[model samples]
Target: MDENQEAWYLWRHVQTQLRVSFGGIVGVDYTALRHVAGILGITLDTAMLHKIQALESVLLKKVK
Candidate 1:
């Protein structure tokens, strides 16, 4: 898959899994997100990164 699609899928997968495992309102941990992104070798823009830091539940439908 393309870079953007892969990023979205991974983000959603982590978000869903975190929520399921935690069994409550769980936000994607910033450190974990960054580590995952690093492993996938994808970079998120400054604005998107800021959003993730401030708004934990933001879903990136498409990266433009």
Candidate 2:
């Protein structure tokens, strides 16, 4: 995928995760994230793992 596609894929998944994990706590759109797995064609754990890896890579870069 292209950069935009990759960024969008990541962003959408992260947004969904945040909305699910923190929607009630932070007022994210809970409804929008309720069906994230169906919408993204990924298991929740798979998406979360990738997001965490992406986060780790960014932090590692900051330490470099």
Candidate 3:
């Protein structure tokens, strides 16, 4: 896959992980997640993170 596609794939994978990790928690702090992503070398902007969180929220709602 190309760079953009690769980024999206990684983002999706991370998002799914975050959803599962935080889905059962009371407060999901995205700042911590973003920091962890950065530490893991995931180059995601705030806008992208916001989009991922939005998508995750939708998925969580559906799964509920």
The prediction achieving the highest TM-score against the true structure is 1
* Model 1 global lDDT (CA atoms, 0 to 1): 0.55
Using lDDT as the measure, the top candidate is: 3
Clash pairs for candidate 3: none
**Which pairs of residues have clashing backbones in candidate 1?**
none
Q: How far is 35's C-alpha from truth in model 3 (Å)?
A: 8.5
What is the C-alpha lDDT profile of model 1 across 4-63, one tens digit per residue? 565555566456434323444555666677777777776767855754444444543221
lDDT of 3 by residue, 1-64 (tens): 4645544555554553442345473323566566656776776776666666666667667666
Ranking by lDDT: 3, 1, 2
Candidate 2 residue lDDT tens string, 1-64 = 5534543564555553432233233322434444654577744465555654565456445544
Q: Find the number of clashing residue pairs for candidate 3.
A: 0
Q: What does each candidate score in C-alpha RMSD?
A: 6.9, 7.7, 4.5
Measured with C-alpha atoms, the lDDT of residue 4 in candidate 1 is 52
Instruction: Look at candidate 2 and give me any clashing residue pairs.
Output: none
Q: Of the candidates numbered 2 and 3, which has the greater lDDT value?
A: 3
